[model samples]
Target chain A: MATIATTPVLPATTRTRRGHAERPSAFGTAILLLGVVYCLLPVVWVVMASTKNGSELFSTFTFAPSTHLLDNIVELTQYRGGLFWLWMLNTAIYAGVGALVSSLVSALSGYVLAKFDFPGKGVVFGILLMGVLVPSVILAIPQYFLLAQIGLTNTYWSVLLPQLISPYGIYLARIYAAAAIPTDVVEAARTEGAGELTTFFRIAIPMMAPGLVTIFLFQFVAIWNNFLLPYIMLGDDHLFPITVGLSGLLNQGATVPALYTLVITGALLSIVPLIILFLALQRFWRVDLAAGAVKA
Target chain B: MRIAFKAGALAAVAALALTTAACSSPASTGDTDGASSDSGPVNLTYWAWAPNMDKVVDIWNKSHPDITVTVNKQDGGDAAVTKLLTAIKAGSGAPDLMQAEYQKIPTLVSAGALKDLSKLGAASTKSDFTAGAWNAVTLGSSAIYAVPQDTGPMMFYYRKDVFKKLGLKAPATWDDYAKAAEVIHKADPTQYLGTFSSGDPGWFAGLTQQAGASWWSISGQSWGVDIDSAASKKVASYWGGLVQKGVIDNDPMYTPAWNAALNDGKQVGWISAVWGPGVLAGNAGKTKGDWAAATLPQWTAGANANGNWGGSSTAVTAQSEHPQQAMQFIKWLNTDPTAVKALAQIANIYPADVHATDSALTTAPDFFSDQSDFYQVAAKASAAVQPFTYGPNVNVAYSAYTDAFAKAAQAKQQSQFLSALSSMQSTTTSDLKKSGFSVK
Candidate 1:
């Protein structure tokens, strides 16, 4: 979801910055306005819909805001003794720890692949890249089978373990490593008799900090937004991530309409944390850092 | 550089082949044989996914002192089956009993995952269920695999106020319904006497079955697909004519647009299953007390025959060691008067039991103006539904029909509908055959 949501903004924001550097063009402003509206429309709908009771959701005009926002939130919180909060916490644990570990693994792997001159180095990088092309969803069922064989499924470890080896993250880290971590600096660090591990942790890691953060942000959002894996893996509601929990609630809406209100309110609440995370991570965009690395 | 990259890529692809090694190998079901410990009271694990099911489970636990069953709520519908299939293939974590839609019974039976309940006295309880519901849970002659639960008998619900203004009485047959469509459309171009949703093929199937179209059947160890039968052709033309002529509104149901249309009285009534009343009340809250229900429009003069839409049943998995206790719980849950009454509140439908005389099905909903008896009409339809079977290919059939009908709705051609039906028929046949079933 973060990947998709951020896609249009990357190029658009770049264009806007150039426009500010020069003279603002009306055409550019119009396109920016269109993009803004396109991205915000669903959020606007969720806000308006969350303010409606079950019946008013369909009967009233879509944009009309009702007075039931608080009521809807109360109902959502009360659903199964505030199970919504549990789903949120489970998601945070999965995404938070999963992304942290994934970024480290990707960084170290990518660093080694990029800097080392070893046999089968290119093959390791190629296989990791090939892994990216194979859709993640295909891996989920087979992963389930593998995990179930060892009795690891239906546990937090099930979700966390599969997500930690993100092929795309490895690919991105490889790109960042080649571009940002110059071999010269690492060679110089090694000449000082520092251990290879110390050189990586002290020099290459600090230099690759922005890139790792970028990888972390991508992975965090990917695991946070994933629905199918958790839906297939976890049977216990207590272990459900927000996506599966909300989707189950949504399906129940076919029989119980009031659940629709809860789904809308829950959706509105779910985005708040991700939005804050994005806002906080704005400095990791690394356009300046990359430019400095290229100059060096 | 480029040559090394190419060789490296080849080697990587070769190395990656290890991941596919386990694809062919299936994991054995683990140590889940919990039903073997005798002497002590039997602890049964039941998996179900209906709303308010815990309340009913509590009632069952309270009544049966000797047998205590623990309920595990799993995702319902197809996801439930996927999980069950995985667990069954693994040979572990299979619940003692599970609830699934009746159409899914054949798939589980063919996979040899479901227990044949003939050994557990399911044969004696055949008369307790609606014949159609009973037929749904059974194989060729005797093997009853699941205990029938709630049923969704097809019925017609209408906005009584809109119909009264349009001088339209409850349609007794399809001909009268079409004629009413003409009247209503001529009076107000925006108004329709009835509607047909191309997206909901189950609704079409019910209508076709009402016209005596046996699209699916089972003979001696072989399945038959007759979706393009003459009766189905008649159903297509009858509804297709109304859809083409713009007499009946073709607004798709269960969407925001459809809800607005219903609230605006764009269609005088709706033809759907017993569950339609609850769905309508949920969607059309403003138009409450202005609606009523009648039996699905008959085909023959004063004749009575209908078709079911959605319902589910409880079946014991083959993994269960205590089939007798599982059967007792299933029968009690479905047939016990108190249990059925409790279930009615949870599912909000008529239980499959024909003899459970719960007056709730007869009471007029506040949304229906207290003028029309929704559940009583549904009960009549349930009794009239012929004992028909949905084969294992029903899911594949439904998806194919969905795509085909979406085209027919857009094309607005009877030939298109026939072509779609034929395509679905062939697909269902081949799919069933591919699954190692003898399909003719």
Candidate 2:
């Protein structure tokens, strides 16, 4: 109860200390903009390249926009009764939900491991840390066999199930939990007679919210950008993620040059939501690596 | 608000649960007894990768009464193989009929993954097929795995206008071809007479077959390292000279350089397999009428006259529920003249059926102007094509050769390139021999 009263006071004092004005770092802003430009070059090329007809694509300057973007979209949409859109939807389902579940699992697992002394605690932590170093590509063959044994290969579960356990995600969450949640708060809640589950839900999760967002975004991008695992796992075209689907288009672009336009357009479209997500979530990124350090 | 967020999350989770519930469960039992509705009309599942030939399936489905074939355009060959391998490993999930490449059959068959088409009753029909194309589909003497779809008869295609401008006829031999290329390059500094992607040793393999060399033994067993062989050295030195002399516009396959050559019409001629016509058409407004066909320039006095490059086949997987139906479809697609003709028109493919039509040889289309009937030209070139024995380690070996060839081309190293190719071939041979192929 004393800590709960003081929590409101601490935030007000911190806000007052920051109320007047803070000068932005000129060099930092410039460096960040430079980084933004470096990343945006390829994306910008794809957007402009997609607009040109096959003949015009290589004929004109690489960046000079052309009139065929709408035509390319129409062609791509009609390629197989809007199968591209279906792929887009499947990818959204896979990445969006896969990341959500993975983030939740990471958060819950991390919170418990960080805040409590459970049985086999050290073993779990060590194993999860090792999992972070293990490459997903190495798991693809084994995962395929395991999934195939259960008759799960070629279905949506084939892709979704393997991606649900994010090792890096749990690692990040553990770090975040340790940094954000205070052991004293958990003890105080326990003294007030809150059950372990109740303490986790009411006290720890909210404190860990910002870190969880970072975990969610990290997992989201990892799953979204992933090509090899889904490419290896999902046999059905209808179940393909955008990366796999776009690469398929590019392969045909070898024989069918007309497909180049569709591939470029699809590539451009795939990255749009990702860029938006990053921009929207920038506020959660740590400004200083030491900002979360605690006082003794 | 907190309750609302949790409720929203719960609802999303519930939606996922609902969707997963709706997904078709992995078949609880193998569709083995041929049990999926002979009563309500048989639904045959066929898988292919042709983005343009979905209509061929629809046309076939509309034409057939007893069986309705639903063709699903799967991903590329590698993806399809990976899927099929997984399914084969599962012992149940493979499609009823699948379009596999002729080159892939050797590996697939050796793996014991495909249902023997000979068992499915296509043995005699497959025998009546063109020997070279059919050989590409067969795995050794016993197991006939796939039925040939189209024969990729290697032919030399030249830009008649460009050839005329350079005052040269289409070269009749490899030496002549190289000399003519040099002449053309000399005549126009900017225009090279020919270009080939060295990165794809498939053409080299075909050339080797033409020059009486086999890269691997069929039983997945032994390999012949022709890289250091007299004919192979000649082949490498000849092509290398063209690149070194700067007479050939070197365009690696699927690169911007290759695409630019097509768009600009810079290369005078290209030697490609029969399937190259479709590749030309697929490029649409590019390369239209700028090309004409001739027999693949042979190595003068070479043991073999011509050889196949790229072709594909259809086969029944071991997991197929209805092997008979699968064979029927493959037989109709490959050996039936009428079906082959229909597919040719729709897909612009030259049929694998040796007897499909002599007209397939001579029907002069305006696209090539006086390129004559493509079928007849291809038929002539199809002769002297010895069987290409694809080693079981063909995929890995080819990748090795490709890597070596790339480094050689870029770095100008010849001995290293030959050594790399030899090692790759020997490894493949050894792997195949271990896998039970009879390699001499």
Candidate 3:
């Protein structure tokens, strides 16, 4: 009788497990789908609007696509003798260089804090935690004042320097490093006569490759989307990033009509590189998530 | 580890050296003054928002090689002023020249951002501009602050096709305008004569100006705010009654919805300024050759009075070391026949120079090709603008107007509109006093 009861309970548990696997929460999925539609609607609108010329933009249907995308791009490219392309180049330099250096600094700092038992390390981490709570927008005016004191307010360095030390990036790196890079590897490398910098660059850095890529991608997108810092720091349009440059096109003043078509097209073109970068680096994110699962 | 420490220390030293080098470089370049006997080429930077201003400066750059001006186009009036004020407070990084609006001159002067140009031969160009335009830069004082670049004299624009279809003539008085609005709305529920734009404080100020209202005045070191004066209240109530009666739409201008309204002929008229053609052509391109310009409907019949709207002036900043050269560039930019002509043609602005109408604006804009006398009507309206004074705290007043009127417009209440004016008056006066200005 006991064996028969146990056999019935086991089959019931299996049946419940299969049911859970086969069915999803309908209400939860409806909310999530609503959120997705809300997020994607504006992007779809921009894509559709960019294809319409100035005359057809407001008069036509909101979602109806037109054939003026190429014409709009050509006009935007010809604006002020191809100044929009210069803005794109400036954005690339700022985000590309800024993210690379930021990730390197974050990796070093985070790895040392995770592995090393240095004095005042708690104080340093506490300060970093506090910094993570402070919004970056509040820092722009003060950064502008500081840069002005050094006579570097309008230069490219003014924008690059302030973004290099993101506290949140370092914190993220710390969590990632503690989980990914084992201390045993560093000690083994040291026992093999590898120098401190040599071990960090060769052993720990390689072990933390997926994580560093995550940090790099995060910083890259942040710097790319940053507007207030560069807007306040740089005075010269030649030094302006795409965000500031596109804003200038729209706010040409009360008298002149805004360059709506060019701005819309520029916005669409600006997102293409971001999409490509995401697709390229998405594999790294997958590998990072799966690494711990494989170890378990 | 020791090698790493040494490398880091060396890098720190290098960064210090670089910063010092940068600090000294700007100081040396910024020290040279045009007042000095050095005939060296002066590189002046101008912060302006007018389109194709670079082309206008190209003309000057070719002729005056000694002082080459580079135009750094900025976002419109308020944003550029905020940036300029920040730079002025920093004691560096300000452009040599800025496009100052007439209302902002008082604020800029009070902040010591603008250099008084009267001592630098700006007085000679006074006769070139209208008296009302000149009065704005001077603040009713002896000190001249800016050169008038353009003026936006308020005018009435209506769709000729729509008016003809309805068998209605253009209204010449506010009473007639109300009757026409009722008739048009009764004929078609989707159509309206105009809209009450609460988002634009400048537009409201222009309407009040036509009613002989000066919102601000200064007398012997004291400021006066009269935002809720009888004249302003009259203008507000008139617009509010129309909105409440549902004859006019209580929507803001310069929005996508309004653009659509203008395009589809739901909005049949626009109470805009001389610069209206460019806006109409850009927004309602299909409606071209079907619109005509006339003077704003009179408060009293045959009054022939008008008000000013969007316009800007060129001012030299106090931080500029090359004030002399900066003054020369602005004078040429505003008054030179070729430069003013370029401003009208390429930049598409109504030049503030009194003689600009005689020479530069002989032809009508393409949008109003049907109305050949557009500029003539504009010039007549420009000559009739009443004098208005702007206080140092116009920004506070303007923002208060947006806040109070936005709610009133939403509620569609006439009493709320009048109360909005009182709120604006109190907000402006209190802010002036809070900022340590004596408000009476």
Q: Rate the local accuracy (lDDT) of all candidates.
A: 0.76, 0.69, 0.86
Give the alpha carbon lDDT tens digit for every residue of B240-354 in model 2: 7667667786556666666566667766677777666655555435668878787788777343388777667888766665666666777777766667766677666666777
**Clashing pairs counted in every model:** 5, 12, 0
DockQ-better candidate, 1 vs 2: 1
Q: Clash pairs of candidate 3?
A: none
Question: Candidate 1, after superposition: displacement of residue B417 in Å?
Answer: 2.7
User: What's the true lDDT of residue A167 in model 3?
Assistant: 94
Ranking by TM-score: 3, 1, 2
What DockQ does each candidate score versus the true complex, computed on alpha carbons? 0.27, 0.23, 0.47
The count of backbone overlaps in candidate 1 is 5
How high is each candidate's interface RMSD, in Å? 2.9, 2.9, 1.5
Best by DockQ: 3
Reference contacts preserved by each model: 0.26, 0.35, 0.59
Q: Which stretches of candidate 1 lie over 4 Å from their true place?
A: A1-21, A114-119, A174-204, A252-259, A286-296, B1-36, B39-45, B62-76, B90-94, B319-325, B358-373
**In model 2, how many backbone clashes occur?**
12
Relative to the real complex, the DockQ score for model 3 comes to 0.47
